[model samples]
Target: MNLPLHPLHLKEGGHVVDFHGFALPVRFSSILEESAAVRERSGLFDISHMGHFEIRGSDVVQAVNRLISSDLERVPSNKALYGHILTEEGGVVDDIMAYRFGEERVDLIVNASNRDIDRKWIEDRLPSGVRLADHSDGHVGMALQGPMSPRVIGKILPSLVDMGRREARTLSWKGGQFLVSRTGYTGEDGWELFGPSSEGFTLYSEILESGKAAGILLPAGLGARDLLRLEAGYPLYGQELTLDVTPFDARLDFAVSRSKGAFVGKEAILDASGKPIRHEGHPALTGFFVEGRGIPRTDCPIENGSGAVVGKVTSGGYSPRVGGGFGLGFVDPAFDREFRSGVSGKVRIHGQALPISFRPWPFVTGGILRAASV
Candidate 1:
């Protein structure tokens, strides 16, 4: 397959690896080193493959609010929202980031693999006057994430540093203009930049060079990105979230605005919220820390005290910062109490049972300095 490369991939001797059909860098340096760098200092990521769309019309906000679970009415221009586009039955279509451009315009950032599906879904539900345009092809995106990301990038791009979390502004840098948002997937203070593809390459080079001079930033790869996001308690699309699962099941009720009026999945979601919690039929997403070696991989069966299958692992890996294995997976809530009572459930990995215990999300802390200040 012909793999597509992000602009940054062209600059950093990025060893291209096929990731879900897109050519992405597995690592610019070593995965372990890059992973450690982001946890300790800062790292830059090339995420241009993510999809972008422009929505415009008098009814754009209304149309968008109807399509997503987030409350868009209070979302000011140049601010972004993290939420999900849900099916009429309340199942998640995709986890997305929405940016309000103006009263009549908005932009949507969606997962790369679901780009076409997301665009089509948004268009199908748009009111008659609304217009939806796919801009993924023309724009490029990148993220600078970690504890030192804000200060480092701020020194190079002063305007971006001043922008608070979820805030965005159009600024000029390296002889070009770009839209920079103070946001990231990794639980840290950082910025995500979007602009013309050519200028994106220039900005990527400049940022990398600037970070190099600062000696605190490095080019991070997908491996580091996964570990950082996991530690931060951020869910991955296909893993922690999926079409078979509703936002409520993922413990993302905050994203669903009950007072925002009717949306595509409003009725179903509201009904689900009102019903008594069921401990069976569906699995509850929970966090777990491993007791021994051998990282848990996806589809690893989770068994209860009596050796009965309660659920299965969805995402798991070692936390370099915590120095142990941690993971998120679906488990029967009925047995949740048992696991809480020291029942000692085990995760089946590679034909061996690895003892596990439940742990809370956000295995890492202290990065919410900006949000806390607010």
Candidate 2:
């Protein structure tokens, strides 16, 4: 469960923790400071614990297209597509990124916690002539994220800085193969590097040290990442998304390809279609902010002033960007719609119902969606 960057993190004063079986840095400095570094400039993050699976063969594209929910026909080579791997019943198995390397090969980046399960799920359905390889253990991953991330990365890998959004390229570094993809979890322009462990460590160290003179690129951790993603309105796997929740419930409809024809979970998802069919009285995910001193935490019941349980907080915390409490949770569709229009709701803490309201979306945005930010 030890990450390839474990030693490097220790050497750089990262406060490490046991996150989903792997030793991960919770914060390099304070979470707020690290987050500010990303907002204002850039930050480096170690995400090696995430799973990477390579599928190659003549029918690779067809196999991947049939298994995942996104329309891959349009995603050209050297590009990445974000989508969900779902169960037949329309439940999300895991949200993953598929890096298309033409019609013959693909690389899927999946969540660390669901690595084995996803691999098993995917491999079980592989057709003849297609190959599956769990290359996660052999490589390390790092993210350089922020608005000025390109400027910072330009110092070392100038060519990769302009690879365009969701695009990927390969390079040879220190006698090892390195892949740089313009992809990230935080809603910002960034690059994700995947390569041999030693090379990855070198890349991380070089970027942090070299970028210091130009722009501040701090070493970020899980704490800042969570807050940034929340502010970006991005859903976490175990939180807003789960095996019990369909894409409709999670508001991940964009990733679901209804026109792509016959993929896993398509039938049930079409039937569910924002209803409570899956969870039976289900609540769709929504964003909210707490006023004053109240900070909502996961599993806290959300009510509508009449003392009736509408939903529960899935991810909640203080946002440095919001300068107040901000979190995401699932609530009844009607209640969510009402609160989204600026109407107030209540979050039950202990026995007190503190007033709260839905905070539209992309709480703070400097993401690929420039129009949304504007």
Candidate 3:
């Protein structure tokens, strides 16, 4: 479970932690410092623990499209599309990114923790003309993120700079071809690159050295990455998304292709969206900022002006950019509008109810210079 970049991270003073059975860095210097570095400049992350799969066959697009919520045929060649693999009941199995190379080939990047689950699910469903290849163990994934990412990445791989957002290309680096995508999880203008495991050390070292020459890049870890994604209002698999949560409940309607004919869970999803089952008060995801001294945490109760519990925090943390604690949580559909417009919302942190304000997310964009364009 040791990553290809494990030694490099250790040499860079990373604080190692066990994450989903993989040994990964929790922080390189400090979480706060790393967060700031990404916002102000750039940060490099080792994301090799993620699963990579390749589907190749004459009917690859049609075969893969039947399993996910998004329509692969609609995606332009060499572009990536984000969607979820749903269960029959319309609950999320996993959120994934699918990169289409052509009608005959497609690539997928799935969460590290769900590698086996996703593989098994996909393998069992693939039709006769298509085949799936698991390259998770043989590949290394790396990300260069933030405002200065373009500059830093350009120093190492100049060809990647011209790619538009969500664009993917198989380009040569040191005489070897690898996949590079103008995509990232940190809500920054960045690129996620994948190459052979054997080239991991060299690739990481070269990028690190290039970043150092610019004096604007830092080695970041999971803590900062989590915070960045949270600020961006992106959902995490185990947090905002789960087997029990549907895309409708998570407010990810955009990831679902309602027009894309019969996909897995299509009927259930349409039923859910059309006539939502109001379990747990019929929750809907929303963002909030704590207005008092206390920081919010997961499971904290959110109450209305009349003191009725309307929602519960799913992810919460302090962000200096926000000037205090911020969170994303699920609330009753009836109160979604009131909470979104900053009316009558309060979150109980510890034993006290703290006033809160609501806002749309990608909460802070000042540091996302390059991302702004995309």
**What is the TM-score of each predicted model, taking all chains together?**
0.92, 0.94, 0.93
Q: In candidate 3, where is summed lDDT lowest over 10 consecutive residues?
A: 365-374
Clashes of 2: 0
Residue 17 Cα positional deviation in candidate 2, in Å, after optimal superposition: 0.5
Instruction: Please list the C-alpha lDDT of all candidates, in the order they appear.
Output: 0.79, 0.84, 0.85
In model 1, residue pairs whose N, Cα or C atoms come closer than 3 Å (at least 3 residues apart or on different chains), thus clashing, are none
The stretch of ten residues in a row with the least summed lDDT in candidate 1 is: 271-280
lDDT of 2 by residue, 169-202 (tens): 7689888787679989888889998888888888
Q: For candidate 1, lDDT tens digit of each residue in 205-308?
A: 77888987989999988878887788777888898888877787887767778667778877766754444233236667877889999788888999986788
TM-score of 3: 0.93
What clash count goes with each model?
Answer: 0, 0, 0
List the candidate 3 regions with Cα displacement exceeding 4 Å. 175-177, 271-281, 366-374
**In model 3, what is the error at residue 348, expressed in angstroms?**
2.4
**Could you say which candidate leads in TM-score?**
2
Candidate 1 Cα RMSD (Å): 3.0
lDDT per residue as tens, model 3, 118-170: 99999999998789988888578898888898899888777778889889987
Q: Tell me the spans in candidate 1 whose CA falls farther than 4 Å from its real position.
A: 1-13, 172-177, 272-280, 369-374
